[model samples]
Target: MKSGVLKKSGTNKKKAIECLQDTTKNTIVFKIKSNYFNENYIPSSNTRATTNFANLARGENRQENLRNTIQMINNRFNSLAKWDNPNDDRYSVELEIISVEIDIDGSGTTFPSIEVLKTHINDHKTGKRIEGIVGNNFSSYVRDYDFSVLLSEHNKGKENYSIPDNFGELHGNIFKCFVKSEAYKKNFTKAPVICLSVSSNKIYNRTGNHHPVLGFEYLSSKSSLTEEYFEKMGLKVRYFIPPNSVAPFAFYFSGDLLADYTNLELISTISTMETFQKIYRPEIYNANAVAGQCYNPSLKNQDHSLTKISYDREERTGLGIEQGKFAEQHFITPNKNFLEQWSANFTM
Candidate 1:
């Protein structure tokens, strides 16, 4: 499994401690809850099974939770049906966070500078900027080459670019960053494994480790529409502080998180791959993984699989959610066929 900010058990508890100290103004204590599915501390002997970090770190239930989260969100949007034409039976919506983490600062007895949080939330909503909230003493995660490359490519074509490959190396780097960080790294061995099976090569095994680095930004208006986005739908943002750590967290910086475009990205996997741009899953395309494999490692194969699967093509739908780099984008619209395909797997 790729390293994460959340640990299983018998792991260090410093990061959580530091985070609580920074975020909670009043004296408060927090408990670290491991994801419910984590079972068995030791690894099995099977090579593939041992390597399947997604399966190993997070068992079936946790993965099901994430899948259900996406599924439920899409279902709720379909029920609302305001985003599309009433006549159009097909409708789908993509759900992703603006990606923000609260950095705890020890010694200082206060939450993130209200100004900084306000500015970050504003920047995220306006699609103008994204800044990491790192404490003065907090160290920055050294980004790998692939991580930087994916960001540059995704952000290149537009005034404000979005990372195209979510499941690629970008997610890996972010996980490592969180792992390496002094604040959140403790207690967590790696990020949660949400889903699995996107590239389909069996080369890359874990889900959350390869998940696209999702950014979470606050809504411009805390009014009904935005509040409803979370409150009514159970689309709540994940907020927590690492345990046993100090106060005064650090804020990292990034402009790539600011995505200003008419087109809200559903999933960039398709578009990015079409252009022959690099992807996080080099393993899938790697000479060894693709060489004489059962499925030809190409778009032709993907199209065939997609057709056979017969699922929603409009909304963000796919198997296996990757982390580091974004993948190809799949855009869906209002149509009965679209809605049917999206909900098809749900009842089953």
Candidate 2:
């Protein structure tokens, strides 16, 4: 009676693991070959970025090449478009990164430190803890968008797009985030739905370089303007800790607990919490919140449903407004009474 064997004598289908990979290699940030670069061109620390930049210097069709390069960059940016799969209900996580600003001293003095920090939620929550490793750790991210919501100016989605895999064991600056299911669901939500993964065991060690290097680099806990900005906005600082390579640390916030905000927003608020703190403090990233999805549970079974409504007229504007409003106003706050009032009156 080996594990995974069906009770009825001979079935071989395995029981699915409760957990799934939320990020994929394609979703995580990485450099791909630019067609402009010569076929043999291999970028490196010794080779100046201009060397690669100059690769696009063509003579007659230089304009065309420039246009193509611009388009290439645009395409990459747009590639983060929210996608949903039509099969699994559980496959509903989006990918996003905490916006961070850092001052890297190219003059060869010291490691780059975070200078500014900004996040998806700025007004509602301020000076909170931020998760994820910063400052020369193994993490990767990319920018993506979703069009399910109608307000072009605001660009509020039903959920905060983020991959849900955490690789705390990796010791180097390079790691991979992977996505598995194309299956997505939409029903007038604001964000895309996809699962992502953070995988580490695969290491790529470069020779001669003392500090570790990989296909990509991950930095954790570097300070950013996001924290200072949040503090300016009136959000309170909860936890602050110095960055550590071996220990776990994170920022936390307590908002008026409302039923409307999705679990994802709450999670991301914490994820970006450390970035909002005025003091440097060590914090532990919450594991459970990072693994959850932020879509409207009722709409998790539909594909192209959000897109369909998005193209429609009257239905699109007012659609999903309740969730959108909740997501916008209540990410991280300290008002428990307000949350109680809203929950008592919530009709939907």
Backbone clashes, each candidate:
79, 61
Alpha-carbon lDDT, every model = 0.24, 0.22
Off by over 4 Å in 1: 1-101, 104-174, 181-295, 302-313, 317-348
The stretch of ten residues in a row with the least summed lDDT in candidate 2 is 137-146
Candidate 2 per-residue lDDT over residues 100-136, each given as its tens digit? 1111111211111111111232111233333212111
Instruction: Report how far residue 24 has shifted in candidate 1, in Å.
Output: 22
lDDT of 1 at 275: 12
Listed in order, each prediction's TM-score against the native is: 0.22, 0.17
Q: Per-residue alpha-carbon lDDT of model 1 for 147-188, expressed as tens digits?
A: 333445556768874445322332233333333444344543
